[model samples]
Target: MLVPLTRQSFEQLIPVIATSSQYAYYWGKFPDFLKRLLISVVAVVVILLLKFLLGDGFDPLLFLLGIIAGLYWFWSPVYWASRRNIEIRRYKYSGFWQGRVLDVFVTEELIGTEENVNNRGELVIVENRERRLNVEVGDESGFTTLLQVPLRRTHKGIVPGQIAQMVVMSNQPDLSRIANKSDIYIPRLNIWVSDYPYVQRTVFSQVSRQLTQAEEDDYPANRVVKTRRRRR
Candidate 1:
């Protein structure tokens, strides 16, 4: 389901909006709400088992901290990678749009797992890669919105031009954004590849550039505030 960013639409939809629908495509249950609950229950069960096996000598406080850390390690990616209004950004509202891919590229990342008893359990090193795909789209006003979608997988055979669609949400003024899990529909291959869905394009490129520069015309001149801070 798609909802526009207009005030009236946002007002009417927030109450009825099944925020989980965005994630229902993957996790039939709630990823942020119910999923978290299940994870907590399981962690509690494991901790309980450990306490039983270790007997009265078990330190609940330390076990609680371990549980917290484990939860962080497990759910941080779910909460971070698929975050919505939780983070500060140019956009708060979500909608939908259709577009095409103008270019495609891949970013190789080494995703590995290591376990330890006395340290930050699993060490995660995300090697950032850029220049994945070029997507061309138009808004309701018919202005071109160009998006650069970073391919999340290896060896994604995306061409320079292809048909695709997205569920887009725009921020205020010159900025707008899409969802992170929203897939790029490739009609030719009848397949969807894991790639960046949170794309942004200024309503007017020149105007966006000017505002960016004017924002730098200050005591901190020439420095970016990095308002739309994203962490994986």
Candidate 2:
């Protein structure tokens, strides 16, 4: 079950967060059951090819073993590593969520289950607090409301409790105008996102300088004062 948290809550959990590259790789690219089935077929084909080319006398048992070995090597390592990594770093370990707050506001909520194009969907029950709430959620993905993220991967810094003050759109009267939200887990073969709003652009402005490990010298304290005097 998904639990909610605040930015401060997430910050407290960052220290223990797992930073495994192997986990990140798969968690960031988890596949579905159908895809796993396809992979098994490919594995069998590969085993057959190896036996035909190298096995002077094809041993059916050996070929079967090779297929099994291939599947084992492919699935277990990727799946378990990713799952373990996330588990090690999750709130269960740290006991809270951590992240920034971008903005919070309330609109009519659309609560219902949605269907996926390829697979069955879940029953999403959203309770649009009867009273409009200035909900503070992470807006890194332009998703003000709940988003169905993938199991293996997580959109970094887009954790719950982040805030976004600026808005490109406003709440609808009936909430029926809400566009269908995308399931982040749905894999796309050739997904090409166009004109999408990236966090770097929206999160920071040209006038703002990002911080680095090495601290840079601060701007002269009198700089602003001097500028103000000059304007006068």
Candidate 3:
């Protein structure tokens, strides 16, 4: 099933910025507070270096830099949130597509390497491995894609035949060819698996209900038309 999205379908990103783990995850686990602190530290270091190199006459330039840094620190979160909102808005005309889970599998992924001290007091490189769950889904038109997430105890119940919905962006408004990646939502499990938080949950739930109702209403009519054709 495919349904076009409206302007209201998108939520204000600023309100949910702090609550989104996916946003923080994309920045290598740096939370908003940490980001502010890091930026402040770097700005101070740069100003001190400039003072050492240029001597006393560069006070005005250093003051300007400080103001810029302060403004950036204050508005950084809003800037990032706006960028994310724009990404989702690009797919608004492409419509939402619902597909069925064709298969489900788990794989071990090497996320990174950690340095650990062994019993002999020597640093050893330890590979950090994580279990990832992959769900293969496809629409009636045979368009398929894989949705992956970290395998957690909460995700153990996902299985084949579950409904997976996502915004399908395409150059053609008809969605003949996909253009970008989108967040996936599994309505049955109330689980959203995505690399980023692109969809507004409340709006998505309302749209999903409307689509399901339309499908239910069309079922009997479709069966009646088939029966009449058979009689003919």
Candidate 4:
């Protein structure tokens, strides 16, 4: 899912070009069911053939292991996320792309279920919270980029129609509107941003102190006394 980001918020908005790369790199090459079915079918066929050839000496339990391994190899979300995270860090980690905040909003939670494998690899059931963001970018253009990002991956608020900036790799600089950009070193990605505002405050206060002769040397005091009694 694409993360929601506005410069007004605490997170960064998804980079227009990077989002495309994100999907192409992260999501399953095929639909989940299709991939799972392929894994099970191929593994079962191989396991059955092996058992038949080896006689009863071979354990049928090997079929389950084969299915698990095949599924992990081809369609595991954990594996994909891990790899994608690494790629993002390596490529889009330092450089930044700045743009105006066109829009900011939240999306309905996506309800779904996936394998709830624990650290020990035990299966369980749990509801997944797939938060998403849909932000339209581009101030003036025939085409605008709609950025879809996961909320969990987002945390910034520049507000609607405000100037926003974020990190993108040097290779995909075309993704952002503004060009001639350079590397902006920041800690993380996916945030909201906006134009800075003016604030008013009182800065000075009265203070008591004693000054020595040297401290007041710049302002020399000269006094003269004159009497005009005769003129009276």
Which model scores highest in TM-score?
A: 3
- TM-scores of all models? 0.37, 0.26, 0.69, 0.32
Residue 64 Cα positional deviation in candidate 4, in Å, after optimal superposition: 9.4
Of the two candidates 1 and 3, the one with more favorable TM-score, higher being better, is 3
- Write model 3 residue lDDT over 12-98, tens digit each, in one string: 321235334544544444476688867877887888888889998998989888777756655565567657666655554567788
Put the candidates in lDDT order, highest first. Answer: 3, 1, 4, 2
Best by lDDT: 3
Regions of candidate 2 where Cα sits further than 4 Å from its true position: 1-31, 56-65, 69-232
For model 4, residues 108-217, the per-residue Cα lDDT tens digits are: 55478777889998998886665455455443434334555555433343244433334333333243332222121111122332111000001000000111223223
C-alpha RMSD by candidate, in order: 14.9, 19.3, 10.0, 23.7
Runs of candidate 4 with Cα error greater than 4 angstroms are 1-38, 54-67, 70-75, 86-93, 96-98, 103-159, 163-165, 171-232
Error of 2 at 110 (Å): 18
Name the candidate, 2 or 4, with the larger TM-score value.
4
Clashes of each: 3, 16, 0, 38
Taking all chains together, the TM-score of candidate 3 against the true structure is: 0.69
Model 2 error, position 106 (Å): 8.4
Candidate order by decreasing TM-score = 3, 1, 4, 2
